[model samples]
Target: MYNALQSYTSYPFAHLVFGEGGDRKTLNFDHRINILQIQGLKVPNQKKKPQDYSEIEALSKALLTPITAYTDQFSRMDNSLFKIIGWDEAWAPLSSDIGEATMDSGIREGRSRNTSFALASQNPTDIKGELMNNIGNKFIFNLDDPVQIDRALEILKLEKNEKNRENMTLLGNGECFFRDIYGRVGRLQFDPLFQELMNVFSTTPPSEEDTEAIHQAIQAHTEVMV
Candidate 1:
């Protein structure tokens, strides 16, 4: 998911990532990308210095303020404006009063503004009913726990049948049971067309050697394109 959003950096779209820790390093190198580290609820100021704050309201302010600004900037274009706002480990932030509102606003008005929210979390049930109701598409990945599966299915409004439970538990990595915008449900697999992206998008910590190799591969690929 991080890699998919990172791809937009090469284009004209605006992408903002809200995540934490070592994961930030993978997406931070590019000047076009903006990352909001969620730890301590610290937000970057105008000078790029993080100001630490503990208020719950701060979360919504940090996230929605910029999005509102960006929407105003791009929504004026003759054509639709395309933008992506991603939040990793989403459950925590979504629980807050204004955090959910921010998400709700994005999902509700996304179509007209041409914005996409890439929110990710381990369990779908952790998300609130109101926020989930606003989302049109859903991707259910593997769940080993039967309790979580039941709850997730209930929230998704799918039948709590054996077949559905079995299918979700049996899913392999990179595979998910998807509900599209039109509410059609089916299985889906993600296969990246570009092989070099696997290295760049990997969740594992990249060694110095691996970093150099991927950089060279991307350089070579870009050269070929030119």
Candidate 2:
């Protein structure tokens, strides 16, 4: 998920934001990368954590602004903005009514605004049925749990034979079954070098020293370019 974000940020007029969940902190991307971090689903300097509904409402509003702006303009612009909203622990959010509503709105309305969503979660069952049904692409990694694998297969509409079941359970690390809305499906191996690069942007909390070093490096590089 982080790798996809890194690649998309390279595109022109791309705006990125992700929620901080679990132990993952806001990642420090390169100085040039304008990825925004929304902490605890609340704007900075708020006294209390926002209610679940409010959080989703705020997120939906943020996502729709660009779309509204572009459509209201007198002249259609060629260099239109694109927003990528990602959720790291996606299931937690989707479990709520507000979250599901927000996601459904985005999935339905995002394309007109040139916005997209990327979600990551451990268990497919934890995801809401509506959101799961709406997803156009899926990446199934190795799963030891039969229940989870079964749910994934059902969602993907793949036949559950002994051979297919065994393949899902035994896939190596970084190997996954990739399927798109266009009826394409295949097993893919992620490149080792690219995976290594993604590790640098991991959201897992880093030590204070490591965080400072990353900031300093980015600052130094930016200064050199200037």
The prediction achieving the highest lDDT against the true structure is 1
- Candidate 1 lDDT: 0.66
Q: Tens digits of per-residue lDDT for model 1 on 148-183? A: 899778765689999989988888868988887787
Candidate 2: count of backbone clashes, pairs at least 3 residues apart or interchain: 0
RMSD of 1: 11.1
Runs in model 2 deviating more than 4 A are: 1-79, 192-196, 201-226
Clash statistics: count for each candidate: 0, 0
Tens-digit lDDT track of model 2 for 14-101? 3334433467543332222334433333221223344533534445434434433332231122226665666666654554444556
**TM-score of candidate 2 relative to the true fold:** 0.56
TM-score of each predicted structure versus truth: 0.60, 0.56
Q: After superposition, how far is residue 121 of candidate 1 from its true place, in Å?
A: 1.2
lDDT of 2: 0.62
| Local accuracy by lDDT, each model | 0.66, 0.62
